[model samples]
Target: MQQYRNKLLGKGCCGTSYTQVTEELQELIFNHVNREHDRVNEHRGSETNPEELQELIFNHVKKDISQSEENRGNLRMTSGSRALEKHKLPSFKNLIDLIIDDTVFNNNFLQMMGGMTSLQSIEIFSSDISVNNTLFDQGICKMLHLQHLEIWANGLMGTLPWCLANLTSLQVLDISYNDFMGNISLSPLKMLTSVQELRLSDNHFHILVSLEPFFNHSKLKNFYGPLPIQPHMSLKELDISINSFHGHIPTEFGAYLPMLQTLNISRNALNGSIPSLFGDMKSLVFLDLSNNLLTRGIPEYLATDCTLLQFLVLSNNSLQGQIFLTNFNLKNFLYLQLDGNHFLRKMPDSLSNYSLEGLYISDDHLVGTLPRWLGNKSCLIDIIMSKSHLEGPIPLGFCQLESLEVLDFSENNIIGSLPSCFPPSSIKQVHLSKNKLQGQLSDGLSNISSLTTLDIGYNHFESNIPDWIDMLSNLTCLILSNNDFQGEMSIRLRKLSQLRLIDLSHNKLFGHIPPCLNITIVTTAFDFVFDSHLVRIIPLREEESVEFTTKTISYSYRGRLLAYMYGIDLSNNKLVGVIPYQIGNLVGIHSLNLSHNNLTRPIPLTFSNLKQIESLDLSYNNLNRKIHSQLVEL
Candidate 1:
């Protein structure tokens, strides 16, 4: 056998052959393992009493095994094991708490455990949970250790268990988003000195009770959601939205929630001006009283005091009067939606200082020119002042606002040509219709490649249509109508393939109508000729006879002729030529007045085509031949 020492030192092997080294190594391994085992056993023996240690380990394992067995039994019971017999159940005398959040409402379990003296917390949150008088009647008052309880979203019916008032140890209670419908009295919660959070939102609680208890509860920090009207509450966050709460905003609201950081009283019929005391709530960060009848001007004191506010929405209210920005110190405002108010007049000048990213003042009767100070708000992305009474030219300063994306001043009194300096790269729509403006269309307008709709109609403008208008590739609606303009229609107009409307009427323009105009989406009422005047009458020539044809004739002779075709009044002109026979081709003609023109011959027989003629006037023409039968009526 070879003896091998565990130590790392150079030493001669103790009487062992190399062939037997393998067996030696195995023996050494066995010996080392045995030694380590012995050492561990010795350490364990010195540290703890063996019997006590064994007992502790056995108890832990046993407890785990028992708990597993108990869980198995509970699973069996839940799985509809043989109906639990009341006598088979163990006594619940030591039960200190019970919480059930499932479909299993064990009636026998409740009956057996209701009398437990140490039962403290009773929390049942389930869709099937039902609350009745029987729970209280069955000795629920015995709960002594109950410090906090919450039963939410349960389909519980009937009044809250009256015995809840007897739970002196309760510190918190939440029975919200449930089907409970009844008068809620705070008397039961008055004794809960240790309560910190109470939530009863979305419940059918309609009665008003004394709130003095909640007001005095020093530890209460959150009393939120739907709540019955009470004098006051010691809350840091309160929400009474979506309720039938009416009457003016309670002036003491801020006083009661001195530490409140959020307060939402929206969706209520709350009326009257905002209470000035709201300015005292220094801790408030979010205040939403929207969707109410709150009237009068927003309190300047509150706006200045709530400098830390991030969201202050008072929309859909009767709030009126100018927003006095000088008094407001809004440094952290992110969203301010004051839309749907009947507030008239200009926005406060101090609005230029607001750092609002999203602002909506739509549907307000805001009047006067759009404030140029708006350009100072460099952070504004969306500004909707639609349906307002804003008038005058769009401020040129708006072109400087590079951050503006949605700028809507539609349905307003905005007049004048769109600013030539308007940023061509950013503007999307320029709607300036139904106003009193007079100017040639801006040649620089073609620079706005982003333009989608340009409506500047119903104005008095005298200028040729800009040829550059065809450059707007994105243009969709082009409404230029009811104005004073002249010149031949532009051939370039045919290039506006995206045009949806084009109206040009009631102007002085002459020359052949552009043939390309037939392709345009245009609706016009144009008079091709002006009223005629009188010229000197001339003698008839024996060699030339009166001629009529379908075509209009220009006379070289200085006299007027009276022949019926289409009615004509070329009464005064230097036009000279024999009336061609084509004039009589106008069979639909009703009247004729070539009366004050140059010399002409006897009336042609082709006048028989004037069957529809109603009036004739050859009075001032030079004619010596016998009158024809067509002239008998004259």
Candidate 2:
């Protein structure tokens, strides 16, 4: 094999003044590396691990490119997105295992792997690999020694090739999250008697013929497929979730899978009652049957039947009954999720027995005061009890949860002042919106210095926005709308440069819009707020909007397309003044609402600078004259 090596002799003559890389150059390098990796990995199946190959290529490219950049000296630079080229492979005969993720796959890549007959494991994920019926005839069937094959999230289409049955030596086969449609025959899967694990979930396989094909596979340890299963002793893990499997769970499920350790049948059409025999599965560690139609209360036997269970999730079911935790062996329990159910009981006192890490029982009819015993679980990290009808004050004992990170009590009737029990500097996200919480914002909130989001909107909070809010340097979102707050809009808000979204509308405030709310200051602060809350709201990207009563309409923006945005809403307030000319300095402000305010003056000429403004509402204001021609163009 030919070897390629290049050594840099010394620094360039202009070493003291090396040129900083331009965005264009960085993007060019990124694209080059990505294309090269794709080409190489598609052609070569090598002894060199894919990760090592990437490092070798990067080191080689950086060394040769850095010296050239030094010669270019100073140049204008532009901002660019970050990129990471996936590691790749080179042709080598004896390669055993290949795992590639988050890379676009093509037909050539498949052809390259087809030649690697010695491979034992092959896993590809989050790629664009298209697999049709011919995939097996081309190369996959060549891997007679293949033990494990997983190709997930690759947009695979067409029926699974029957030739898969030829790979009888297969132990594990996972082909999930693809576009495969129509009914799939289980006959081929049945032939793989040596298979230990199988996952065909998240595909469009409408109906599976029978569980008889799987019954004979005594070596099957993990199964995630349609059709009711008569489990075997070797089966340890099973997940048949997000399917159309309906009817009552078989009472003998525990007896069939005697050694089962993990079971998840959530988000299915399963109805009827949960099998009490599930508690008898001694070896089971994790159980999840959430988002089902199971009725009646939880079986009391579960507490005594499964001693080793570490994770139990039964949220989003129709189960009804007073939840009591007596006699439950919760010593080994780590997580408990009973949210979105019809359990109309108070927070169970017995839940405090275990040292749990997560507890989510939201959207249920749990009444009375917040459980004080929750403080005993010092190891608790996440607590989401949103929309639960729990009333009264938050317990002071909750502050003992020093490891807590997420706390949500939104849409509840919980009354009283904010509790000071939060573990200082530990919480990251707090949602107390749409509650009856009253009184001034507590100084205790300042203790949680790590808070990134704070929403206390839609309450009877009668006070001024606290100055300490600016001290929460990491805050990216602050929502205090619909409160009885009365004060002039605070100039201190301008100091919070990281804020991306702020909703203080519908308050009894006065005075001019903050002149410092211009784009220059906002753009500087928002530079660090990219990629923060973009993922969860992607579906709403095109119609990116926030609803307010200013214009009695929802205004939309371009969303992530314009990643850095600035907006201000000061409508329906007791303000009286001319719109500030400084507001025009906010060239990047996308939405500005100042309607229904007692302001008397002509619109400022500076409004012409709002080139990027998408939604501007100045209705119901006592404006004297006609709108500016330049502003009209905007």
Per lDDT, the best of the predicted structures is 2
**Local distance difference test, candidate 2:** 0.66
lDDT of 1 by residue, 1-634 (tens): 1123223112332211111112222111101111112111111011221111100000001111112233323211111113223224334455444444333333444455465666555565552423355455565655666676766655666667656767766777877666667655443555566777777766677544345545557777777555434444446777676667778776776765566787787778889989987887887888888889999988877888877777777888988888655667878877677877888768877766767666778778888887888766777666667668888887777777766655666567777766676644566655454466667776667777677556554566667777787788766445454466566556676576554333343343333323342212212221233111111111111111112211234221111221111233333222233454544654555445554445366775666666666665555556446767874653
Error of 1 at 600 (Å): 50
Point out the worst 10-residue segment of candidate 2 by lDDT.
Answer: 1-10
Candidate 1 segments whose C-alpha is farther than 4 A from its true place: 1-158, 161-178, 186-195, 226-234, 393-407, 416-634
Q: lDDT, candidate 2, residue 420? A: 59
Q: Judged by TM-score, which candidate is best?
A: 2
Q: Cα-based RMSD of the predictions, in order?
A: 30.1, 9.1
Over the stretch 366-419, how does candidate 2's per-residue lDDT look in tens digits?
Answer: 888888888777898887888788877777777777888877787788888876
Off by over 4 Å in 2: 1-90, 181-186, 420-423, 518-567, 578-591, 600-615, 629-634
Residue 134 shift from truth in candidate 1, angstroms = 13
Error of 1 at 53 (Å): 30
